[model samples]
Target: METKIQKWGNSLAIRIPKSFAKEAKLDYNTEVEMTIEEERLIIKPVKYKKYKLSDLLKEITKHNIHKEIDTGQAQGKELL
Candidate 1:
């Protein structure tokens, strides 16, 4: 697909069509790396580490558990 380059705040910008964006898993605030290869502009999504709650929980043990902290006396109605 051909996309026209438009002026965007003193820089040239091109809009990626929805179909292409979806195929590349691009969404709002997604980080992408841009480079030039063989006189062609290449845009690739930066892979981000995805964390799962269950996987994180498996690493916790009694040896690494933190003790409770004391904040002196409560200033509000938290005592109630």
Candidate 2:
């Protein structure tokens, strides 16, 4: 489980073993957050909340819904 830091272009990189990556649920192109603690580096997945249509609709109510605004007739060529 020991791996050396290799030079990746101008930055140093460490390879995460397949077994560790699989256990951490890390995949190709997966968003991750990296943070450094007192003496350790922490890497975690950046999980985003997926919103549903019904869940979004619930946020719109009479108190917060916008009313239709009446703009005067357009004088320019708007028929097209």
Candidate 3:
């Protein structure tokens, strides 16, 4: 697809058509990775990393000394 670079604020940018953006599953504020291979330029969406809160909590508890604190004194002792 051919596109013309136009002035955008302080930087130059090419406007991707709505049809092309929709076909590429791109929306406003979407993050994309750009690269050049030989004479061709490529643009791809960046994938996000997925994490689970429960897994993170379990990992933290595995190494936590205060997770089994039963009393205020025990907690205070652990704190000190």
Among all windows of 10 consecutive residues in model 2, the one with the lowest summed lDDT is 70-79
Looking at model 2, residue 46 earns an lDDT score of 94
Q: TM-score of each candidate?
A: 0.58, 0.69, 0.55
What's model 3's overall lDDT?
0.82
Q: Write the per-residue lDDT of candidate 1 for residues 1-80, one digit (tens) a residue.
A: 77799999989999989899999988888999999999999988998789999999999899997898999999999887
Candidate 3 local lDDT, residue 29: 92
Q: lDDT of model 1 at residue 8?
A: 98
Q: Alpha-carbon error at 34 in model 1, in Å?
A: 0.6
Q: Which stretch of 10 consecutive residues in model 3 shows the poorest summed lDDT?
A: 68-77
Candidate 3 lDDT, 1-80, residue by residue in tens: 78798998999888889999998888999999999999777888889989999876777644564555465555454665
Say which prediction, candidate 2 or candidate 3, comes out ahead on TM-score. Answer: 2
User: Runs in model 1 with CA error above 4 Å?
Assistant: 49-80
Off by over 4 Å in 3: 51-80
Model 2 gets an lDDT of 0.91
- Residue pairs in candidate 2 whose N, alpha carbon or C atoms collide under 3 angstroms: none
What ranking of all candidate models by lDDT puts the best one first?
1, 2, 3
